[model samples]
Target: MRLHPDIPPGPLHEKWDNCRFSNTLVNPANRRKYEIIVVGTGLAGASAAASLAELGYNVKSFCIQDSPRRAHSIAAQGGINAAKNYQNDSDSVFRLFYDTIKGGDFRSREANVYRLAQISNAIIDHCAAQGVPFAREYGGTLANRSFGGAQVSRTFYARGQTGQQLLLGAYSSLMRQVAAGKVTIYSRREMMDVVVVDGQARGIIVRNLLTGELERYSANAVVLATGGYGNAFYLSTNAMASNVTAAWRAHKRGAGFANPCFVQIHPTCIPVHGDYQSKLTLMSESLRNDGRVWVPKKTNDL
Candidate 1:
C-alpha cells in the first residue's frame, strides 16, 4: 500500500507556511467544471462545502438529517481553544501545539497538531465575524475561559451552546452557497457505499432514509465528515445518528485509518445511577470553571 502524509519540509513553525506556498492551486476558471461531494453537514462538512462552493466549485452536500442544523455537532458545549494571546497570557501557536501534544500523551503527529494550532486564530476570527455571539467581557473583548488541559484562559465560548452557535454560522454559509446555485443539498440521505473506479474514489451510493431508494452520485472528489462511532457500543453518549458506516465503507474502498482509538469524550457527565438508563446525558466539561467537583472519598462511600 502507498500513502502520502503530505508533510512539508521546514521547521515546525514554518511548515504550515511552506505547505500553503507549495500546494498546487485549482484555477477558479476551471473550478465550476469539477464536482465535489461533501457528506455529513456538521461543522467540518458544512464549512468545507461552503468554502469550496464559494471558490466556484459545483458541490453536492449530503446529510443524514432533514436539515443541516440537526447534525450532532449542535450537541457540543464548552468552547474552542485558540492561541490568540488576546488575554496577554503568553499564548502562542507553539505553546498550543505543545499542550495538544502533551494532552494526547505525545501520541499525536507533531505536524498535524502544529497546523491545527496555527489556524485556530483564523477560525475564531471567522466565527466571530459570522456573528457567533461568543461571550465577551464588560469592556467588549471576547471572553476567555480555562478548560481542562491548558494553563491559560484561551477558550472562546458562546455560553453553553458553543457548538450550536458555531454550527449555525457554518450552516448559514452553506445555505448562502445553496441559494447561489453553487451547492445542492440532499437531506435524509445516508451514504451506503463509496464508489471507486480505476482504484480511485469517484462517487458514492446513498440510501434515501424515507423512501428506501438508492441513489448514485458521481463526483470528482468525496469528503466524508461523518462523526464518531460511539453508537457502535450498546450504550453511548453519542448522537444516535452518529455511526461508523460511511467511514468504514470508505476504509474498505482504500481510505487510511489512523489512531482509531482516539475519540472525543467528556468525563464530566450526568452519571448513570442504574442499569435501566439506556444512555447518559453529557454535561459540559466547561462547568469546571465555576463549580467545584466533589466525588466520594472511597468506593465504599457510594
Candidate 2:
C-alpha cells in the first residue's frame, strides 16, 4: 500500500482533527441534488439516512422489517463500546485503538480504527441528546461497564437492552425525518439487486416482501448496510432472514469482501439438545460473574 503524500501523519489522536480540516466539504446548496438510498434499518444505516436528510440530501431508506424498530440491531444483548473512561478505569482512546487492532489480529486498518475511536465519544453524546434513556448514576450522568477483550469500563449501556434503546433512538430520529417528508421510508421492502447504470451504483431493485412485487428505486448513490454473513455458518446468532445476497451480489459486481472467515463464539450458549434447534439463546456475557465452567481431567471423573 502506497501512502499519499497529501495525507497527514500523526499520533492516532490527532489524525481525525488533521483530516477534518483538510477534507473538502460539499456545498450545502449542492447537497440537495444528491439522492442517497440506504438499505437496512440498523443503527448505521438508519442514522446515516437520517443524518443525510438532516444535511439536506434527498434520502430513501429501506428495511425488510415492517417497522424500523424490528431490525436485528434490536437483538444486541451487550452494549456499544466507546472510550469514555467514566469509571476512572485508566481507559483511553489509544488503548481502545490498540486493543481493537490486537483483538482483530492486526487485520483492521489503523486509520479506520482510529476514526472509530474519534467518533466514539460523539456517538454517546448524540445518543444522549436523543433521550435514549441510558442507564445513569445517582448523580444523573451516565453508567459504564467492561466488555469483551477491553481492559477498561467504557461500554455504555441501557440495561441488557442497549441495542434496543440505541436503535429506538436512531429510529425516532429517522421517524422525525420521515414525518418531515425529507426521507422516504420504504418498509417491508427487501433490496434484490443493485441497479448499476454505469460504473457506479445508480439504484436498486427491491421486492415488496408482502406482495412479491418488485420495484426499482433509483438514486445517485446506494448504500447497503444489510449486515454480517453469519448465516453462512448454517446455524449462528444472526437473524434467520439475514443473508449475504445483497453484499455478495455487490461483490460479484465489484467490491471485495474483506475478512470472509471471522467467527467469535462465546462460551455461554445453551447446550444444543438436538439437530432441530433453530437458534441459540445468548445468555449475557455478564453471566461470567456468577457461573463457572470446569472440566475433569479424567473422563471417568464425570
Candidate 3:
C-alpha cells in the first residue's frame, strides 16, 4: 500500500489528534439504540464495558468468574505501562511503542501498538480517578518504576499487586453501571459462541456455568474480551480454567485470529520444584532490576 501524502507523518502525538477529529461519531440520542455485549471481565473486557455503558449504550456484560473481580487480569502481578514521564527521564511514546514492537519481536501491527500507546495515558488517569491507592511519592504524586527492557521509570504499580489494584478500578466502574441498570452484568456465565445474522454480529449463545443451562442472548453487537489462549500450553501463567474457547469460537464465526503463536515467556518464574508441580509462580520481571538472574552451568545442577 502506497502512503497518502495528506496523512500526518511527524509523530504518533500528531497523528492521533488529527485522526480522532476526522472520525465520525454517533449522536448522543442515537447512541442509546446500540446494544453492546461484552463477554469477559478482565481489565480489557470490564473497562471496555464500563466505558461503553457510560457513553449511553445499552450494555450487557458477561463473565465466567464468580464475580467480575475474579477475571484472570487479577492474576497479573505486574503493572501497566504508560508514558507520563513523571521522572523526567527518557520516556516517550515512540520509545514505548518501539519497546513493545521489539519486545513482541516485530509481530505486532504498528497501528495497534501506536493506538495502545496513545490511550495508555488515559488509562492511568482513569485509574487514578477511581482511587486505586497506587503507590505514591512523598509529594503525593503517583510513583513509577521500571520493568523488562524499558529504561525509564514509567511502569505504575501498587505494592506487589498492580493488576489487582487496576482491575479493582475497572471493576468499580463496572459495578457503578450495574447499579444504575445501564449495564446488565451476568456473572458465572460462559460464552459459547457469537450469533451473526446477515453478516453482522447480532448476539451470543451462553451457558450458565452453575446450572449448566444454555441460554440465547440477542444484541446489536458483541465484544469478546475473554482474553488470550496462553493456556493451550496446558501449563502456563494463565488461570486454571482460561482457554481459547471464546476467541476460537469467534474465529470460527469469522473473527480472524492473527498471530496465534505470539507468546512471550518471562524468564524469572519459579523453577518447577517437582514433577507434580501444578503451576509456576511468576516473580514479577520487576524484581529482575534489583535481583540478579543466574542459571547452573551443569545440566543436572537444577
Best by TM-score: 1
Clashes of each: 0, 0, 0
Which is better, 1 or 2, measured by TM-score?
Answer: 1
In model 3, where is the ten-residue run with the lowest total lDDT? 1-10
> Model 1 over residues 1-302: C-alpha lDDT tens digits?
68778788889889889889888998889999999999999999999999999999999999999999999999989999999988898999899999999999999889989999989999999999888999999999999988875888899999999999999999999999999999999999999999999888889999999999999999999888998888777767888777688988999888897767887777887777787876669888887876758579898897
TM-score per candidate, chains pooled: 0.95, 0.90, 0.91
Q: For model 1, what is the error of residue 132's alpha carbon versus the real structure, in angstroms, after optimal superposition? A: 0.5
Encode model 2's per-residue lDDT on 1-302: one tens digit a residue: 23343435787678778888888998999998889999988988899999999999989999988988998888787777788888988888888888989988998778888788878999999999988888899999898877775768888888889889999999999999999888998999987788887578999899999999999989999989887777778577778866778788887777667667876565677667688987667766655633445557699885
Model 2 scores what on Cα lDDT? 0.83
- Which ten-residue region of model 2 has the weakest summed lDDT? 1-10
Native-to-model Cα distance after best TM-score fit, residue 43 in candidate 3, in Å: 0.4
TM-score-superior candidate, 2 or 3: 3
lDDT string, candidate 3, 113-231, tens digits: 87788788988998999988888999999998888868788988898898898899899999999998889989989888889998788999999999999999999888889887777
Clashing pairs in 2: none
**Best-to-worst TM-score order:** 1, 3, 2
